[model samples]
Target: MKISFLCILIAAIQPFLWAGAAKFGGQRSGTRYDNRAPRDTLAHLSGWPQRANWAQQNSFEAFPIFAAAVLMAYAAGVPAALIDFWAVCFIVARFAYFACYVANLATLRSLVWFAGVIACVRLMCAAI
Candidate 1:
């Protein structure tokens, strides 16, 4: 199936997040905290914000593909409203996912993931 630009956009974001990850710790030591280096291996291993950044970047990669699905619907001339609804849900879910992900809240992150899945279903239904 042909993916749309929106999907591509979502996919593109993951690498960008990865690129921004802490050189030694994702969120600290930028002269903010007294800590010279983050003690968390997650930050130092991958660097910055530790596990959160890793998870965030991992989750972030999926958006553009979802966006592509939305775009595909548009190109196929599906109703704009349907596409709009799906897009909004997708974006919101991703944001929530990111927030919960970085915070390391597994429960909320799962919910957010489900919401994104719902968005995909909605998009697929609309396209079909």
Candidate 2:
């Protein structure tokens, strides 16, 4: 697969990592991961775990526009190198965003989130 397409797969899978962190990361209060009531359990998480869950939700929220942008870039015949570059940018920014969220670095997270958005927008605009 092209790297950009692979990036889409990575993007799709990234949120699960944050979910796992929210459920399984250190700082839990004697409660096992409640797969049976995951959302409820996650909703009660605090500190970094809570932040991880938020990151997971944000990651899910971010995926569609990014995926559409990449596909649009492909359909519009954007250069493969440029597509790959922007996709990589998005992935890197997202990873940073996740870290910042978990670390409670709100300002840095917002900046990285903007970076990811810019990457997606660049991809979509390249098609236009």
Candidate 3:
């Protein structure tokens, strides 16, 4: 399988990492985990934990675009090497994005988010 396909798999699970961090961090804020109403529970968290929750949600939001780009690129016969490069770039940018979010580096996080978007766009362009 192409490395880009592997990236798709990794990206699929990336959001859970942030979600887990948010859960653990929220526990630090004395917020009990409410399995029945997790979003409400997370809403009560503050500081880094809250940011982590947002990061998790953003990761979820980003996944579909990235996944669709990869699938479209593959279907359109984009070269594996080029697709892989952009896919890796997107994954790295996402990791940086998540770190910046948790660190409360709003500017850096926004920049990283843009970088990830660019990577995804480039991957999609490769299909044309």
Cα lDDT of candidate 2 equals 0.93
In terms of lDDT, the poorest run of 10 residues in model 2 is: 25-34
All candidates: TM-score? 0.65, 0.95, 0.95
Collision count of model 1: 17
Q: Output the lDDT of residue 114, model 3.
A: 100
Residue 25 CA displacement from its true place in model 2, Å:
1.9
lDDT by residue for model 2 (22-125), tens: 88863365546767988888888888888999999999999999999999999999999999999999999999999999989999999999999999999999
Q: Where does model 2 exceed 4 Å of error?
A: none
* Ordering by lDDT: 2, 3, 1
Instruction: Give Cα-based local distance difference scores for all models.
Output: 0.62, 0.93, 0.91
Over 1-128, each residue of candidate 3 has an lDDT whose tens digit, in order, gives 37888899889898898889999998987888899999899888898999998989999999999999998898898888888899999999999999999999999999999999999999888887
Candidate 1 per-residue C-alpha lDDT over 81-127 given as tens digits, one digit per residue, 9 for 90 to 100: 67776777776777677667667788998999888888877787677
